[model samples]
Structure formats: structure tokens, C-alpha cells
Target: MSVLKPKIMMLIGCLMTSSAMATEVEPYNKANAQQLKQSIYERTATATSAIERYQLAKSEAWLSYADHEYSEGGFTSAGKEAYIQANQLLEPSNVNLVTQIISPSQVMRRDLWWQIEYLKQRGALDVEPQALANAEVMLVWAAAEYCELGWRHAREHFISAERELQKVIYALPEEKPFLNWSETETPELSALNGKGCHGVNPDLWPLKPKTPVEPEVIDADVANVVVENVVHFAVDRAVLNTEGKRVLEQIANILAEYPDMNITLKGYTDIRASVAYNIALSQRRIDSVRDYLLEKGVNSSRITAEAKGKLEPQDDQKIEMAHAKSRRVVVYFNDAETNSITVQPQWRDLQIER
Candidate 1:
């Protein structure tokens, strides 16, 4: 019995050594590449519906990265893993993935799952299909890039994903006041702290309401899209701060959504600066805002930005506050179709806040 036990142990050791682990070298070649490329091509070819196409795009992006890896670095294992994940998008019907796409191996994808799930909760997929679709596809691509071969070549995709998601967050149609984002003020752009998808703060994502959004009230104040005291400059400076950029980003999103609603940016400065300085300063200010809007894809024709110099106050009470308020840009929106605004004459003409 002892002799038999030793022989059995020896046989077990031989089996374990033979199947120790996957070979470091890959079985990748031009033939294998063509085979995989063709396989992924077939799995996602018949996508016609919005959801199907959405998933299909993600699969295609993953396949592209996989092909790059195989051709550039001879990485078969990671590429093969990515291919498997990509195919998951097309198979088993993407209707099941409306809330969240399943990624089994790349844990980084899990970091971004909360965002996609929240958007589904808000029901924003249908509201901004192209934007959200682009976001989702880039998100999976980021996950694959970040994880595959420990390569950090996914920063571009991560940034692209964040920008698209930003559009969906602020651009979705809503009857309510946009979780206080639209009615109250523009929230600061989120930062990445090596956590969620691209390190964006999930808590910063707007709190979606229980009821669905109302498209009729997309820009409830369509005639006055920029109704708030949005861009208030500091002392005599015209350069936009972080807060100003945030405000403009939201306005840009609005303008992009409603191209028919023309925007007016009126730049103002404090009483301390000379009239000439204030004029140039205010010009710089509005120019800054205008250039920002243009960079954000707002048509130049849709904007009417001018420097209004300073608005002399009537009293000295809280003079500092008044000066701060004076150094501001008043944003007003008018319907291009009617060439008019619903706001009263005084408000439409920029009532100088005392």
C-alpha cells in the first residue's frame, strides 16, 4: 500500500507540471488575427435598432483596440479577453443591458457602472441617445484600455467619455428644476480621484427625480435661457473663474440643444475702474465668454455679446456688494422665430441691480 501511494503522488505531480499555467507566448498570427476580426465582424453585423446599434458600437470599439494590441504588441491573451467582452454587447440582446453593461474581468468598468445605472434611473438614454451612446461605448473602451496589459493608453477615451456624459447630465429634458442644477446654478466640473469612471465624483451627478422628465419644459424659460446672475467677475478682472466656466458650459449645452434660442451676453465692470478701462475690461470679459461659447460649439451667429461698461448704482449702501454685482455679464435669451423675449421691457433691457 505504501509503494502504491508513492506512485500515485508521482503521477499527480507529473499532471500538475504539464498543465501548470497558460504559456506566456501567444498563439497569435495573421491567420488568427483575420479569424478573430471576422468573428467579431459577424457577431455584431445585424444591429439595426438603437439599443442594438449602441451595443454593436461598443463591440466594434473593443475589437479595434484588440486588433491594435495584436498588431502592435503581440498581446493575444488580453486581446482575446477584450474580444470576449466586446461580443457580450451583441449577444443575449442589449435590451437586458439597458441599466448596466456587464463586464466580468475588467473591474475598472465597474467603477463607471454607477454612472450608467444612474442615467438609466433618470431614463436619459432615450432623451440623449447619441450623446449617451457615445459615452457608454467610450466608457467600455476606457475600461478595456486601462486594464488590458496594464497599459495607460486609455486617457483620451476616458476624457471623451466624461465630456459626453457631461452633456447628458446637463442636457436631458426636464420639467422640474434639474435637481437645482438648471434653476439654481451650474455645478462645478467634477474631478477624477482615481475612483469612479475616469475618477468622476458620482455624488456630483445630478440627483434624478422619481418622475420622468418633461420634454416640453426642456428649457422651461426658452426665451430667457440665461435668466440667472450667472457670470459675475471679480473686482476689475474680466477673466472667467472656475465658476464662470461652469456656468458657461451649462449655457453652451443649452444653446447647443436649442439653436433657435439666440443668446445675448452683456459684459459690465465696477465703478472704480475708469470708463475707458471698464469698457475694455468688459470687452475682454464678454470676449472671453464669447470665445468660450464658440469653443463649445455654439454658432457665432447665435450669440450677440457686447460690453455694457459699468452700471452706476443709485446708493452707497453695501457699495462693495454693489460693485461686485456691477462687474457681471447679463445673459438673456430671445426666440429667433419671433425676434422677441417674454421678459418685461425693464428686465429685457438689463435692469441695473442696485
Candidate 2:
């Protein structure tokens, strides 16, 4: 009977209504392929983020496969390859790579649902709001894919999509109530804003504050300095966390002290997802590190960033420790004196297990 209870109930009602509306869409038709492809390509071309680009690529590949299946009667070998390529950009497992054809339409829908769920589990909802929007779009696309397969597939997809959408909607932050409100907010309603409500936990949103680290000094007289302080990142995150920022702060101070020294940040990732995704993720991480250095007053000309992705994992074993070690960015430093004195760069020929 509390005032906030009514507000919470109203919000839930509205979300349920939206979910219902989402399920009432018409059946997908083959003739929409060209239009869908064009739309997807346009989005890809203008996408500012890696996730957005990958989402568009997935949509393009799905539509292309659908077009081939409906118009040409079943998937052509070439078309299947294209599908695999597109799938590889987001996740690069060998099992997904070696598949000869696209997954069953319903299975694909389920896979999309799981991928979105994975993102939500990993705290992407708070860190990357666009991912939530992309997930919703993907669900709608999955529903359409099911529509093409027939009534039963469509029904299953619709139900799945509705469930997923409801979760996302409930996860979104609620608006603050007016200060002058006559009624008191219940403890449950207040807790929703802080710790989340209706199965959503705001504390788990992955946006933790980063602690600062003291900067390290690099010896200018050294022939080559490779700081073993590798910056680690969470899965699919380009933004630096507190620990990462601290490491970069140290690197920035080193760069500031040795104005003539140049640094390269080589980014690498664990073998969890696709090569393309890892590569892109690595680049973003390095870029973030480099940008932090620049912000800390390092010359842009003295810094460079490179991405090796999953091709150069620190540990190739399929273990948590291996994956943790692999998701890192290493700093390599060289001064004019050091570069001239050394016959060969230390890490140039270093072999890393993929």
C-alpha cells in the first residue's frame, strides 16, 4: 500500500504491455531481405562502436543466409561460409568455425538469447547501454528468423524474446520520485534504486570505482625496459578499470620523465570469443591506455598501440588462469640510446601460444 509500490507496479505493467506489443508483429517475408541488408550495411558503415559494428555484421549475415535459403532453396556452400565469417567476428570458437552450414533457425534464435544473457551476466547493461539496445534488436531479428521457419518456431522465439525483453526492461534504472511527494517510499522500493529490484541487482553492474596506483620510474640508461606490469581488463571491455588506470598512470609518469623514450602498448586477449572480436577488443584496450597516457601529458608522437588478439595468448590452456593472463596489455619502452645499443628487440621474436 506504499506510494512507491504503485509506481513500481505501473512501470512493470508498462513493460509488460510493450512486450505484448512486440509479439504482435507480422510474419517476416523473403522480399524484405534486400531492404534489411541495405539497412544493416548502412548501420555498419556509420557505427561508432565495435559492438554496434559486430551487431550489424551479424544481421547482414543472417539476412543473407535467409535470402539464400528462401530464394535459392537451402544454403549454398559459399553462403554458409559467409555466415561463418560473420559469426566469427563476434565469437571465434573452432566449433562455430568448422560448421559447414548455418544453425537451425530456432537454435540460432536460442544462441542469440544466450549471447544477450551472457552480456547481461557480465555487467554489460551498465557499462555498455548500447549493448542492451543491440540485444533487443537481435531478439526482434531472431523472432523474424523464426517466422521464416514456420508457426512453431515463431511461437517459441516470441516467448523467448518476450522473456528476455522483460528482463532488460526491469534492469533499466527507475526515475527518481519528486521531493515534495506526500507519501513515503517503502524500503523495498528504495532498495530497488540502490541494489536493484525484480531480480535485477544494481550492485552487480560492473562499474566499480578504480583505485589509483603510484607511477613507476623507468631507468633511462637501460638498453631495454619491459615493465611486467600488464594491465588486465574485463571481458569485452575497452574502458580502463581502476587497476588498469593505475598501471597506465605509472606508464604515463615514466613517459613524462623520459621525453625522448617511445612506448608501444601491445594488446592481447584470451581465446574466448572470435578472432575478430578479440582483435577489436585488444585494439580498444590499447587505445584506452594510450589515451590515458596522453591525458596524463605524454606526447602523442611517442606512444603507439597494437592488438594481437587471441593470436598471442599468454597461456593457451582452456583454463580461467590462462584466460586471465591473456586478457592483458603490456608496455614496451625504448629510448634512442637503448634502441641504438641493443642488437635486437627483446620481445620482437617472442613466441606466444595461440
Candidate 3:
């Protein structure tokens, strides 16, 4: 059995999925022939060095061959081989321009993986519907690319692809009228989507843009994911207990190992108090946690503390324990998914003051 190339197959699938009326050449078209040809000339001419110029020339030659092949009929075997060779020699900059300005008009062959790159150039942020759809196309193609590359960095690309796809999904009701795509497609797309790519929280994707920095290393096989400890205070009291100081020490040691990791100290409280009072109490707890961490030499910017009273309880069962758990602050490593976690033996038995 013959295996169809992913790009060619995907294009065919897309065509099959859409109505022929919807397949009109205008809405999907990026640029016209004159514009495309002009871009080719401009890019080729504007190339700064001999190397860049040669690469652009090679890309233009391939575009010419592709146009001829599509419009004027088949090429000779030798001519086809020459076209392939010229394409292989093209640089990434030239390749990007060719795809961005020309690929929409060309016949997508087995080697067609250019459309996704074009869409990546227009990420999902504040883009039009067609552009966002094009980004989704890029995302699907990115999955195929990652499958082909099979590296750790491929995880980043795969996640980015999903993010773009998600934006398209979120905007669908606003974009197309009376059109609802099946949620079943989510499983297929979600398979390759890696966690922690959707920004700081998993719930928000594409909208929240957080840099995925590598966690810092501290001791042997230990990395600091959070630079400070999350401490709980009694009501409005900001005093630190022995156990609280011990937790801070643990956080400090981890920070010493990995001085670059950022920390988020979140405070919570029991539901016994009024909403406003609890909110203020939570805020105070967070501030206290922040101050403690800052005193331990952690940068102020690296530490962000927030208080949410009774809103985020640890568990509903055992109300007292849950309330106690709620009245405490917890530290989170910004990039915990990619980092190794270490638990100091003594820090496991923490008993924060009520």
C-alpha cells in the first residue's frame, strides 16, 4: 500500500469536508499573480547578501516551475528533478516568502507543507477568521512536522499548534454563522497537544502569553520551581511560626539552587468570614508570604502573591481541615511541568500556625 504524504492528504480532506461553493478561489487566496510575482521580485532584489540573493532566486525558479506545471501541464522527468533540487537549496527566509505570497495558488503536491508556516506568520492573536483558519491549518501541519522530527523541542511546536487551533474554536460562534463543528474532533487534535503550553494556567490558552522558562537547578537532582514558601497567617496576624520559617528555609534552599525560578504565592481562607473580610485576610496572608520570601533574597518581581478568601478550598470534606488548608498560602513553580520536583525530608512535616 502507498502512504500519502500528510500535507497532500490533509488538503484533500479539507476539500472533501467543505462545500464546492465554499471552495471558491477568492476567500482562500492570499495574493494575486501580479502581487505574488512582484513579491518574488522584491524579495529577490532586496536580499542583502550573495547567499540570500541566490536562495531567493532558487525559490523564484521553483515558483515559476510550479506555476508552469499547474497551468501549462506536466514537466519532463529531468525538469521535475531540477525543480526539486532548486527547492531543496532555498533558504528559510525565501521559503517563508514563497509560501506566504504564492502557495495558495499552486497545486498542493505530496511535498506541500508550506501552508502551515504561512499561518504561523499570522498567529491567532487578533486575526481575522480566514487568517485564523489558516493558522489552524498550520497547527495540523505542525503536528505532522513534529511527528517527522520526533524531538523534545517538537513538543513546543505541537503545543503552539493546539493553541492556534483552540483560538479558532473559541472564535467560531463569532466568525461563521449557523456553523458548529463537532467537539469529537477535539480528541484527535488534543492527542498531540502538550500540557503547560497554554500559558500560566491550563484553563486559558492562546490568550495568556507566558514565557516557558527552564527551571533553575539547586542541589543534586533538585531544581527550584518556586523561589519562596507559601505561608499561612492567623486571621490578620502576619507573624511567622517555627514551621512557617522551616518551610521558608526549604524554599530558600531551592531558590539557592535555582536562582532564576519565579514564585507565585497564593493565599486562601475559610468560609466562616464575610466575603470582604475573607478577601482582605487572604490578601494579608499573601502579602506576608511575599515579604517573607523577599527577606530571604528572592527578587520582588519573581514573587507574586494573591489572596482569595474561601473561594479555593482544598477539599469540601472535613470542613475544619479544609478551612485550615484554605487559610494558607501555596507556592507554585511557573514551569513545573518541565522541571524536576524535589521534596526536602524535613519540610514534609510542615505545621503552619492557625
Candidate 4:
């Protein structure tokens, strides 16, 4: 069977063109190209050592290949050959540039996997376990892309990424930063794992599934209690400020009074960023609130947190005030008459006594 069917190759061609079009513009194209060219030449001229020269050469090779691919409107055999030549110049010392500038989509070949292993063997990525893990995840994604294209080496890339991820997981400490492994559900992961890649080892996975916590029923009298406080967050942050903590304290006190009443924290964000980023940020905001409440003696089961992301904006206007109003966490008790309270424009505009 062909690695990539004609239709799949056509779709990839469309995507590559679209990506270039999205970033290119009439006024900037010529200037950007000239600037890149100048930078490359300057870097090459300033190279004082063999390593520096090799790095510069590799960069030039990649840039040349990228230009060709963009101009030609798709990946070509010449581009792949240039990439392979560039790969020979890569060493552990160049890992920083490789990680920062090279993306999986740009180097979707066995050579990419070779470079990854070369860096690992040299212990250059020892301090960057998290980054290595992320690269592995991207490799898995790239493998899936290759599989769709019907590339013969798709399974090889998947197995390589899986092994690299496993190594990183083994070296990591018990406590680590949040790594979204939800992409493991991709058909590629399942397909590759079924072939004995073992990419879905839960023991090494950082994020274990949490048991669903149900909200408690609110008492008839407690249902009359007003629940309209909006907890604010700093721009692009999930850490609660002094004012946010104070607001949560008030909510905690109320929850203390009504033991049977449950509170739902719905998080939101302004639409300034991508949908995926905003959604993640919104979830982090509510998680910050839920954690603070838990610390203040609020029952975990009685509080439920949900992320509405940019979907539920209090005001649709793109002004600063509207943006501030949109980036908030709204509190609602399970049975409280909460619908009447109007969402204020900003944290400062709230009627709450500071």
C-alpha cells in the first residue's frame, strides 16, 4: 500500500500553502526575506570556529529548503535532501537552536528522530526533561501525519517518540509541571501502542484521572442566598491576588454558613488569544479559585469548577472594560437565585465593600 494516497497528499499540499499565506503579506514579504538573508550572511561571516560555521551552514540549508518549499507550494525531494544534509551538521551543542526554531512539521523524517537520540546520548537534554517530553509528543503527532500521508516510516517515528517519552518519564521527579497527555487518545497513539509501543503507560503519566466530584444539594432557605461575586485574575495569570483571595474568603464564609449548599465556579477569558489557549487559561483560573477555597476549609465535593473559556462573555465589546469583565470566574450556588445579579464591568466596579 502507498504510504500517502493521492488525496492525503493533496490535503497536505493545501495546508502547507494555507500556512504560508496566513503569515505572508505584500508589504512584509520582500523586507522579511531580505532581513532573513542579511541575518544569515552576517551569522556566517561572524563564525570564528568550526562548530559556529557548521551551525551557520545548517541554518542556511534549512532556510534555503524552507524558501524552496514555500515558493514551490509543497515539500519536494530536493527539500528533503537539503534537510538530510542539515541533519549531519546537528550536534548536542546545537540542541538549543534545534528546539527553539525547528518544529516537528518542518522535520518530519527519520533524520529528526536521529537528531533527538543524538542529543539524548550526549546528555545535552538532561536538564530539559519536560522539553524532551514535549518534543516526543510532537513526534507522535508528526508520526500520525506521516501515517495519513502513507509514509513507510510512520511506525518508526511513533516507536522512537514513545521510547524517548518513556526515558524522560523515568528521569522526571514525582512532582512535575502539568503536561496535557490527552492527545494520547489520538488514533495514532492507540494504533502505535497496539503494535507494542506502550505509549500509554499510566504509571509514568503525570496527570492521573481525578474521580468526579458531585456538587451538594442546596437547602430551600439557603437557595435564597445571593451568590454574585466575581473573582478577578491578573492578565494572563492564574495566581489569585489579594483582592481575589478576599473575595473567595467571603464566599467561603457563606459556604460555611450553609453546609448543604454547593457552589459552582464558572471561568471565562477574553478572546484575545487562540481558542485552545483561552480555554486552558480559563480552566487554570477556576482551578486557582477552587484550590484557594479548598485551603480555606471548603469541602472539595461541595465545590465544582467549570471552564467556559471565551464562550461566555459578560460583554461582547472589544473595549478594555469589556475585556476585563469577560476575564472572570462567576460563582453560583446549586440552588441560589443568582440570575438577577448583574455582572460588573471590572473588579473595581463591584459593589462589594473592600
Candidate with top lDDT is 1
Q: How many residue pairs clash (N, CA or C atoms closer than 3 angstroms) in each of the candidate models, in the order given?
A: 0, 4, 3, 5
| Candidate 3 lDDT over residue span 29-119, tens digit each | 1244345456657766676643344345544544454454445454433234323433443435222112221211211111123222222
lDDT string for model 2 (1-354, tens) is 011123322321132111122222223354444555566666667877534544454446455544554566665433443433333333222111111112222123333333344343333334333434434444444434553555575575455444444334323322111112222312232342232112222332211222223236567886364433467766667667665676677667666667788877889988888889888999998888888888899889887778899977664222544565577787877666444322211111111232
lDDT of all the models against the reference? 0.53, 0.48, 0.44, 0.50
TM-score of every model versus the real structure? 0.39, 0.32, 0.32, 0.33
lDDT value for candidate 2?
Answer: 0.48
* Backbone collision tally, model 3: 3
Q: Report the Cα lDDT for candidate 1.
A: 0.53
List RMSD in Å for every model shown: 17.9, 17.0, 21.9, 20.6
Kindly report which residue stretches of model 1 are placed more than 4 angstroms away from their true locations once superposed: 1-48, 91-94, 98-105, 109-111, 130-157, 174-354
Q: How far is candidate 4 from the true structure (C-alpha RMSD, Å)?
A: 20.6
Tens-digit per-residue lDDT, 1-354, candidate 1: 001133322321231110132233234456655665676467547645545545555556656656766777666555665555444544543233332222322234333434554454454544444566667656656665665534457787777776566545534333222232331232333332233333233333322223334334355545443323347666656677665677677778777677677878888887775788888888888888889889999998988877878764323233544565577776777676334333311111111222
Give candidate 2 regions above 4 Å deviation: 1-228, 316-318, 336-354
Model 3 segments beyond 4 Å from truth?
1-230, 336-338, 342-354
Q: What TM-score does model 3 achieve against the real structure?
A: 0.32
- Angstrom error of the Cα, residue 336, model 3: value is 6.6
